[model samples]
Target: MKRFIALIFALSLFPLSAHACGADTDCALGDRTYRIQMPDTAGDKPAALIFAHGYKGSARGTMRNKSLAALAERLGVALVAPDAIMDDWSIPNAPGQSTSPDVDEIAYFDALKEALISKHNIDPDRIVVAGFSAGGMMVWNLLCARPDDYAGFIPIAGTFWAPEPTSCDTPAANIIHIHGTSDTIVPLTGRPIAETHQGDVNKTVAMYIANGGYSASDSPDMTPDLSCESWRSEQEATMTKCLHDGGHSFKADHIKAAWKTLMSGN
Candidate 1:
């Protein structure tokens, strides 16, 4: 009896597994699912950053990226990584990845937003959405169509596909676009992927500027590794365009820097 009691005591010493629904566990809403990891340093009401994965990427993979997760932890924020459909977004006119009539990513995002606010208990006002490459283009679509859904937007290494959306809902949220000076994959000028050419970063930013009526800020970018310019609208929204010295890369540092600039107006 004493030996059995000792074994039970040893088991009890280890904390009970309440993590089935927590970090490392995938949370589902409808047919889609996402994973969330919270920072230990953040308070009870920490903000969230919903990061969309690149083409052929998964939420599990994004969550496993130590560099990105470390940045989220350092910022005292919750990191939410979402999965794309069939390893690629349902982009319009995207060759084999064309949008399905039944596939409504906007609807999925809408549900995810409400799920984050209600089920996940996140601060709706402090939520930001960001992505990389194809995911970055996804961010543009999300922010353009649902401007009020997130507090801020960050798109890295990608913009709209060719024949970009002519109009976007306004006033849009604060956005800080990050790219590389030597990016040949999704170059600053853009290149043909398969059947469609990528959208020009200048044109994409210009569309947002025209829609939001943002004014340029003469202040120089503070980060030495990046070249940045900023703009602001009367609605209190900020716009930023940033370029680094590398090529088609995903750096957590870049995301951190852009996040700071998006929050800090010129």
Candidate 2:
């Protein structure tokens, strides 16, 4: 974690990376590296979106695709895409597991935000954290574990892995989730494990709604389509589910819709 913090500090000093960094250099947070994508207009103090990639993926891979970058650009938001330690999502098998290589990912985010705040004109209250697949699981962990730090969350094809309802720390942030009903990697029905209990998309949504002080009857009305699917909450905090036609991989249209939802809140 210290190493990753040092890298992020270094990148903040010199914002530059070879590919995804564009003009900004890749920042290190322990053994991880991240890429930043800024909005076209300068001095706008735009809302920042921090992105976590899927299992075995890098920030560059997540941001390299034009469609994802287009969403950030269209929304006029800045993106911070970070690489996971060991090129994989952290899901230790043991209970009370110490983080691999002692990389405290939660703290890494704090440091990244500090650097971003110092270097960019960011709206602190509008910060959003987003992720895909295993990274989506990480997103939920952050929401439950570090609820006070962020305004909202976006998790794609991910599940909650808490052992019990009480284990799910109350989320002070709103959330939007995108999942495929047929996702094999992280099944829509969720998987059973020893250390923690994994939850389906619906369960996760319900949990978030309850945590956000919304009743079960307040669940959003769904608008399903061939290209996109949406569920909007009846409360101040909104939860949307984008049902992908296929499985596993992310759909650009759903991501675009998610971006639209985030921008709408702003």
Candidate 3:
């Protein structure tokens, strides 16, 4: 009788098992909601990957892409997809447009990271950031704002919006720029807005080169694959520019290749 009582007391003192939270319409951040998908496997600490959607896109937008989820599962990593505050993403305005300034996207990422850490046993060193289109721009900003928080970044169909007198205070984070040469929305040569134009792939690559201290003459030959395209970074830093043949759409093959590269460091 005493042993039974002691067993009951011991069980009461222990905490219950906590599971990874799934997509709940009730879970919201600012004016937006999130759809977080974690691996079903149970463990004390798991690597995590946070995904941001493009303009006018929801968490579901990226979640529907089975390839991303599959990669996360294979890697035993958690996947968190958060919605942007507004339907539009916060990107740099034209060269001299003073009326509209870039939104505080870094804050959103910080908040989301805090929430994830509080809820899960995530490995801080293995965190990865990935996004599409406008979301890609957000990823680039996050890399620049908080380079140490993430292991790497994967930006698709988006360029780094260069601020006037470009000043990136953070260190160079591993980056993979996946773009489409035929992208009409955010063209490789940049799109012409009212008076000024936004930065393009060339400008983005240049910024990375300048900030990352890479040699200009070391442009490697393009590696052409059936599903995607790739260019190796000249510097020792792990960076690459992948230009595919399709338009502004997410390709599963491209994502898979990117995932392999990201997880290879592990």
Candidate 4:
């Protein structure tokens, strides 16, 4: 009996099982699911950087990028990559794509964020959301839907559909939009996505500038293969338009720029 009691006490002290998730897994939230990565410091409630992958892309795929993984570790940020319903994010009223009313992408995001906050003690004010391509459009949609939810945003290679918001629902968060000048998939001048037209990048920037109280001045900044023109609003939201020789892709330099802007609080 004494030996059994000692064994039980030892087992209790070092539990036989651990329930924390691995580097990546499908975490179910009510009727939705998200692919999450809890950092080594997750128990300490580290800041989160949630990423929405491009249309038809998986969260694991994005996490597999060595640079992104290293960035998460280097910055001490918890990385949460949520999978979209129907294999793609449902942007509001976007053509050629599932709409949020049907897929409830917004609800999924809400659930995911709440879960992270409750379970991992995430800092609400430190959360940022970023995306690429179709996912980038969803980032803009998220800003429109829940303007105050995130600390910042990075939308790459995508923009809102026509009739973009002239005003934000809430005060601005830091925003950095990265686009390739040679992107034919979603042109800077905008094009028909499917049945509707995505708005011009300049118009989107203009509206943000007006609403964000930014002066209409762009300064030059050069990257390895891209020339960038950057503008900042009084609210600290920034727009960095990069003219790259490539198309419809997120480069390592773009990630670096986005991270720099995010860390700088602009």
Expressed as tens digits, the lDDT of each residue in 1-266 for candidate 4 is 99999988887885221343434656666766666666776556688888888878887787787777777776778778878767677765577646646576777788888988997688887888888888788888887677678877878888887877777665665677788888888889888766888778888877876776766445434457767666676665665666677789886566666666666654
> In model 1, what lDDT does residue 50 have?
88
lDDT of 3 by residue, 193-255 (tens): 676564667767667667766543322233354233233334344667777787887765565
What's model 3's lDDT at 158? 73
Better of 2 and 3 by lDDT: 3
Instruction: Return the lDDT, model 1, position 12.
Output: 85
Output candidate 3 Cα RMSD.
7.1
Higher-ranked by lDDT: 1 or 3: 1
> How well does candidate 3 score on lDDT at residue 202?
70
Can you give the lDDT of residue 203 in candidate 3?
A: 69
RMSD of each: 4.5, 7.3, 7.1, 4.9
Clash totals for all candidate models: 0, 12, 0, 0
**TM-score of every model versus the real structure:** 0.88, 0.75, 0.76, 0.82
Model 1 residue pairs with clashes: none
TM-score, prediction 2: 0.75
lDDT of 2: 0.67
lDDT of 2 by residue, 1-266 (tens): 99999989988885344334432467654455667888987456787778888767887787786877877887788877877766665643312342374667777777778867766668887788888887888788777777667777878888665442434465345666777777777787877654555566776666666666653333333334423333344445555555756688776566555655665662
